[model samples]
Target: MMKLDPTNLHRIDEGPPSKLQRLIRRSRRRRPSTDATSRMAARLASAGVFAAEAPTSSGGPALLDGVRAGGATLRRLAFGVGGGALALVALGAAWSAWQERPADRMSDAVVAPTTADRTGPSALGTTAAVDSAAVPQPLSTIVPVVSVDELPSTRPGLVATSSTRTEVRSSSPPAPRRSESEFAIIKRAQDAVLSSPAQALDLAEQHARAFPTGELVQEREVVAVEALARLGRKAEAKSRANALLTRYPRTPYVVRLERALGEPLSPAPSTSGR
Candidate 1:
């Protein structure tokens, strides 16, 4: 026998093998022995796992329907699990993006405001305090002020002399009065002279007897003369009137005497010297 090199085993193909090795290689190709996978299938068949002839209930049409339904159910379950896994992955990515946005916004909020505040530190304390003006009051009318001394009742008083707030007396004392009895008797006869001359003459005579030298005696005589003329006693009226004129030539009863006498009395002689 010749020795072969161990390091160069591929060179063995260069030499021809004996006849038995040739026969073994040819038989390996002709009728091959069982492989690892085929032997495992054979063992499972012997254990009756793949035996189709085992004696049990034979469901022909119903068994075929059950097999078809079970295959469709398993396919739907696989599709559902695949879709759910895809949805969960998408949701996780979106949640990570959403969580990052608020941090970015907070950083922007902290940094953006200082750039807009361009006014200096001098902007705060530049203004001074101020006071407001008072409201105006309403105007009133002017009242003339008068002095207390101006009132004759206040002997010695201040002389207030402005048109402000003054008060004064606006009235005076009344005139002196006359006697009622003596004046009234002659007055009644005077009022009655033309209407009731008879009553008037009687009242006149009563007055003369009562007040012979009364202050209103001239008026009484004038009333009596007018009463006499009214009673158609012209002669008596002329006589009393002449007596009246002779007593006081300047008597104010001259007009009454003339009216009763139905003629004018002669004017009194001139009292002034030439």
Candidate 2:
């Protein structure tokens, strides 16, 4: 056995640390290294970050501004189109209102003629110096010029003026009409026009002389024209037809008369040769 020493014996008493204490020292030693490596990695990650991976703090405001601008532009476009449509509607309404104005319609309405337009100049202006003789009498009051046989009988009677005195008066009856009614005459002439042309012509002439202003004057003229044509009086027929054309250009008889006159004449066969 070796000789025992005091220093060696103290060193053995404080021999190598225990396993738990060694582990604690080792963890303490590794803590500063791990902290420094983590800080370095954080700085590197922040500094060397890619532009695509970078975060923008101001991006929220810029996106909101773009959206607001787009909305404002759309709002302005919508307002512009809506305003144009409203303006067109207003213009059309104004035009319709103007066209239907009552004053304008009243201006176009027909007005009746005044009494001055109907009355002649003599009846209107100079009534002061006008004579009763010159004043035209009504046609109903005028006694037509007729023969003595056509006139009615006259009766003479005495009319008392005051009770004591008597005045002699004569009352003549209404005159008898010699001319036939215009309608009857025109009908008779029309009935006789084709069958008895000479009699129709004579009746028509008589009607013209008797009732010059008759309502059936045109009918009488038509009957006369047909009768003259049937009687082979082409010259008189053509003359009367021309007069009818001048008077009643749009008459239905005009077409008939024109057709009759325009008929082609047939050629007569030679009697001596045949």
Candidate 3:
């Protein structure tokens, strides 16, 4: 340090400020103004919290979207399952209705002819309907008969009478009419069993009367039993079934007759007190 000169005695000397003092001065100059920061300070002071809002992830919104998607999928699955069940129920009901329909066939009834027409030419030929174009001609009309007198002959040994009697004798018997086959008749009666029970019964009786020892006797019996069952004649059906079983024990129609009678084809037990 040096002493002041006599001429500079009235002047004074000073040094620069330190680093800490300069930092304090700069911070004080950079602080925000009171008017701009007053509102945020007042809000924080009233709530008694100085902490800021924390940062968060998008997990909550993502979870909500996932839940909504799951619910929609479940709803669609339930609707599809319900629709399928309803369709199956409707299909079952239709099948049941179709299965429960009546067994009688109108076509069979119309195709089979009555018993009275069995001897007719139309029935003997075929079971088909008559054609309009192929009509048969009618029989020739009958003519009046006239008697003529014959003169006497002059022969020696033969003597001719004046009153002559006309004797008309047919040389040959009338031609035998063509008839229907036994199998065809039996089939017709059998076909009518379900549609027309009364006609089937009559045809069966006619068959028995016409051909007692026919090859299709067992089949005829079956038709009769079926017709009786259809007509609600349980007693008659049972009697017929018993008779058929007694006649033909090993016949193929035995099963049908048994089913119709609702029992076995065996004979009834002896109920005469042992």
Which is the leading candidate under lDDT? 1
Instruction: Give the per-residue lDDT digits (tens) of candidate 1, residues 171-272.
Output: 221222222234345546755776798888888888777777765567778878888988999878877877777787777657657766778766652321
Residue 103 miss distance in model 1 (angstroms):
99
Provide the TM-score for each candidate, comma-separated.
0.32, 0.32, 0.35
Name the better of 1 and 2 by lDDT.
1
> What lDDT is reached at residue 53 by model 1?
43
Query: What's the C-alpha lDDT at position 242 in model 1?
Result: 77
Off by over 4 Å in 1: 1-180, 267-274
lDDT, candidate 2, at 15: 58
Counted clashes in each candidate structure: 0, 0, 0
- Candidate 2 at residue 66, lDDT? 28
Better of 2 and 3 by TM-score: 3
In order, candidate lDDTs are 0.45, 0.43, 0.44
Error of 2 at 47 (Å): 99
- Where in model 3 is the C-alpha error above 4 Å? 1-177, 267-274
Candidate 3 weakest ten by summed lDDT: 129-138
What is the overall TM-score of model 3 with all chains considered together?
0.35
lDDT of 2 by residue, 188-244 (tens): 675566569899899999889977875556667767877788889876776776676
